[model samples]
Target: MVTTNKEKDLYKKLSIQVSLNGLSFCILNRKDNKICYFKKVDFEKQLDPIKVLSKIELLYEQEEQLNQPVDEVALLFNNALFSLVPENLFDEDNAASYLKFNTRILKTDFIAFDKIGQDTVNVYIPYANITNYFFDRYGEFEYRHSLSVLIESFLSLPKETDTPKVYLHVHKNYYELVIIENGKLVFANSFEYDTKEDFLYYLLFTAEQSKLDPEKFELILLGKINKNSEEYKMAWEYIKNISFMGPFHPFTFEETAKPKEELSEYLLIKSL
Candidate 1:
């Protein structure tokens, strides 16, 4: 099949996000302001370093064979030492190393302790935040960051108008509920809890701190969590302000290149 230059370009560039347990990758046509394809992969069980890269390479080759032209890649991951394998390991002679082909990794779950400049915080992310700790900190942090990026990207879409849009992200690990008023993050915060009572307390505490009336603003939940979980039910029993985000899935991207199922999915969410 004779693929056009435009079509080939569509397959070469990818926006990828690699999480502690999964990968999410997407193809974007920046010139056209369009997303050509996307996919998600889960990699929680495999621990071998070589197996991981082999899987990633398989995905790339699959895409290429399908006539996908991907020359650029964007990767996202947690800020942890264990996940930091040397960039050279994934290389094959003169070929591309997964890290080298895409070195732009945005370390999520990081908080700046010292102010570096205007609006820039010198942040520090707990290693535990992105690792297999006593608690599910890494998963929680990954989900939180993924949800944030997803919401931000949606809001920043080219055609979005200049208006306020409220959002809520519910992860198994955390909840990110916020409002973006006129392209500005008017209010936002993350809460943690295991019990219903604790969750309610955090939400109420956050509402008060943001100074936004729950009755007036819109609320959304992002991840795979029950809005009707007993805790969620009890909290909203009297409060009629909050709303569930979607019975909808994120916009899916179709592509020619395929990665190891796990890495592909992880990168897909990151890039989203």
Candidate 2:
């Protein structure tokens, strides 16, 4: 990211994705539904989102024009409890127990689903006070767990061709491994890995547990990985049909003028 002392253009709508170790912001023109600017700031071994948010608030305060008349800011968390309970059998009050977490710590459990065509009710925990602070004047904003949105993404698109397909969304030092068979989620788990071996172990282990053959199955990788990266190379060595999923926006993803450094964050914003 370029260091700029200049004030930013006040976007009408914005999307922000915050994980344990990073933050990304995309400002948009509401009328055209086009991106104006994107900025990503990654933290090192820090987990407090509140500290990261304070820095964002400082920018808003310093640039008054960028703060006023902002219509909506959608905040999605990378870390959250993901649940896919059958609609009829789901209990709103007992959502925490399903994830084996205390209700007190994760106070706000929001139930969300695709309005048009969805079978299950996916519940996620979003921060209450920090989220509230974002829209103190307006009193409300859109929210989604990172994983929950991905489930909706699969639902809204063309069905997978393979019987057991894996989508590995790699983050800083961790990744979300999911097994989808014909648009049905069979397994969803996140694993923390510090090396290529660690990543491969969790991936193959998940596939083995899910009864998916490595050779027969398709593994589509998303987030932070590239052809030259060790993780990608190691994956290609072991997995047969491994492929990288990149930015599906303004320009179709092809090796272009510059390295698509922020494409992963762009994908998340596109998911919004």
Candidate 3:
């Protein structure tokens, strides 16, 4: 089949989301605003950076969709080593200082920040080796903290009420809690858990600390979670209102790449 330039341009934007627990990638046809490809790999257990890189290398060698040439690439790193700073007080020179209080950092570790709107900056650590690998392959690409994408996308949603709403983005072993009120970010934090009780504790604690009543406020779940999941069952026992987040972006998907759950790849699909 002869490939036209228009066809070549269709799948030019690639967005990847990586973490210790898993990795997901999405290929976007910008001209038509459609997702041409999407795939996700979940590790049995959290792997170290080196092992993660190896997995990524193996994936590139095996996944034909990833081999396509692209005009733009975006990498979103998901990890606990991140902090949000008010834009006015953020200093680029002291990026490490902002994270040191909450996250342990090595002297040799590289730091990066994503400017979220005009009011906040997300400071975190990106895997240097993995980034270098992408650099070698794509020449140049954009990368950001996964929280930045989540925050930005959630903030873009239309406000339904003035009451504070809790958004829980669940992962394999961790979850991000974001509370927004009247379309503004009220609080955001990531919590790690090993049991359903731990998950409930964090959710309730966050609500209490934020002075949001679990019975009154709406709780929207995203990522790898559903009503049937243990986490959801546990949350439902205490939290009176709970629901899953739906797709807010306009991008459509090819049948082969369409996600079974529209909310499953929330961060990766929105990263583009």
The candidate maximizing lDDT is 3
**What tens digits encode model 3's per-residue C-alpha lDDT throughout 46-127?**
9999999999999999999899888788898999999999999999998999998988898879999998877989999999
Ranked by lDDT, top first = 3, 2, 1
Supply the global lDDT for candidate 3: 0.88
Candidate 2: RMSD to truth = 6.0
**Model 1, which residues run further than 4 Å from truth?**
1-8, 27-69, 78-151, 154-166, 181-183, 226-232, 246-272
Clashing residue pairs, backbone N/CA/C < 3 A, model 3: none
> Could you give candidate 2's per-residue lDDT for residues 78-157 as a string of tens digits?
77445556667677666665555522334444434322135566655565545666666444667667777666565555
RMSD score of candidate 1 (Å): 12.5
TM-score, candidate 1, is 0.48
Instruction: Provide the clash count, candidate 2.
Output: 0
Model 2 alpha-carbon drift over 4 Å, by segment: 1-11, 62-68, 101-117, 250-259
**lDDT, model 1, position 99:** 30
* Superposition TM-score, candidate 3 onto the true structure: 0.93
User: How does each model score on TM-score?
Assistant: 0.48, 0.80, 0.93
Model 1, 234-261: lDDT tens digits are: 7666455555543232443445533333
